[model samples]
Target: MNKWLQVSFVILTFALSGQAYTDDSKVSLPDDSIYHLDSEWVTQDEQTINIQSLSGKQQMVSLIYTHCMHTCPTIVATMQNIEKKLPQDVLDNTEFVLVSLTPASDTAKVLKDFAEKRKLNQDRWTLLTGDPQDIRSLAMALNIRYKKSDDNEVAHSNVFTLLDEQGRIVFQEVGDINKVDETVARIVSQ
Candidate 1:
């Protein structure tokens, strides 16, 4: 075989393999992934980010109102505990997302205050508030039911949902924080 021909064949094979690898890396999300929701949210820092922007990391998602006097605080505490239990590597690749059920009242400033009061790690914790309809749509997609009570509190179901790196719900626990170990296991396995 001629030297030039051999060299050219090697280069061509490498290029083709590179192209194949690139194509394989672009995996499509599942049809039911939360990234399919076109909702816009404002972070505690007042930055506008779309729901799909959170697609690349594992996420622990919950719906809450900053002003709630009961279940909301419990939910936040439970999430914090879960964060503490996660392995550092899993924690590094995970985000804890709290979406406001009362978007009208849970402004960016309010969310910021709530985050500060709870001593949440702002880097890993995202508190979001957006259009009421968008919030409602997100809650519905997560199967979280909630309503405003006469006393001005949000009466919501207690639940914690774990979304895989691709934004598909991998595991969800309804009611108390008893499933923290299971949630951590799922995240680590992912």
Candidate 2:
């Protein structure tokens, strides 16, 4: 091939790849809708972590507890699958976070253990457990609802929210946890 044609082809390839690698969920959100964090959040680590701290980066947000026997696991598994599907370049820029709604049941030790079992990247994934009231505050802000059972089981929404780089909510899915892949693709591509 001629040198000019070869260089042109390489540049075109890089541009196309970069476009393909981005998460485009921002385009999916209603044009008038805004994405913003409701309040500063404190973690069970006794460390303060404001949702605004996540600004300028794409993020996947979900609610779960370490002790759950069923739906929670499915939620986590779906999240892991989403991570796997994402390109490495996008994955590095994106963060996956799980908020422990059952603060009492999800201690730091338990969250650490769960992270270890799942082989999740400590830097990339955050398992947060704070006061139940704080959890409720955050949940309400995210439009997530849940109830505690007498037997220690908790029933919560199976929803996941994808926030764009600007901290605006892009997509919210409420149903089978398996749909995370497609929902996330919309965010990453935006």
Please count the clashing residue pairs in each candidate, in the order shown.
Answer: 0, 14
User: What are the models' TM-scores?
Assistant: 0.81, 0.72
Model 2 shows how many backbone clashes?
14
Per-residue lDDT of candidate 1, residues 1-190 (tens digit): 8999998898899888875333222247677887777678999999999888898888999999998887888888888988999999889889999999888789999999999999999999999999988988888888888888676688788987888887888877753678667666766787
Give model 1 RMSD, 1 decimal.
Answer: 8.0
Q: With candidate 1 superimposed using the best TM-score fit, by how many Å does residue 54's alpha carbon deviate from the native?
A: 0.3
Q: 97, model 2: CA deviation in Å?
A: 0.3
Per-residue lDDT of 1-190 in model 2, one digit per residue for the tens? Answer: 9999998898889888875343354444434323332245545454666555666677788888888888888888888888888888888788988888777777777788888898887778887877677678767766889999888888999877777776667777764656767766775687
Number of the top-ranking candidate, with TM-score as the measure: 1
Model 1 stretches astray by more than 4 angstroms:
1-27, 175-178
The models' CA-based lDDT, in order, is: 0.85, 0.74
lDDT of residue 132 for candidate 2: 75
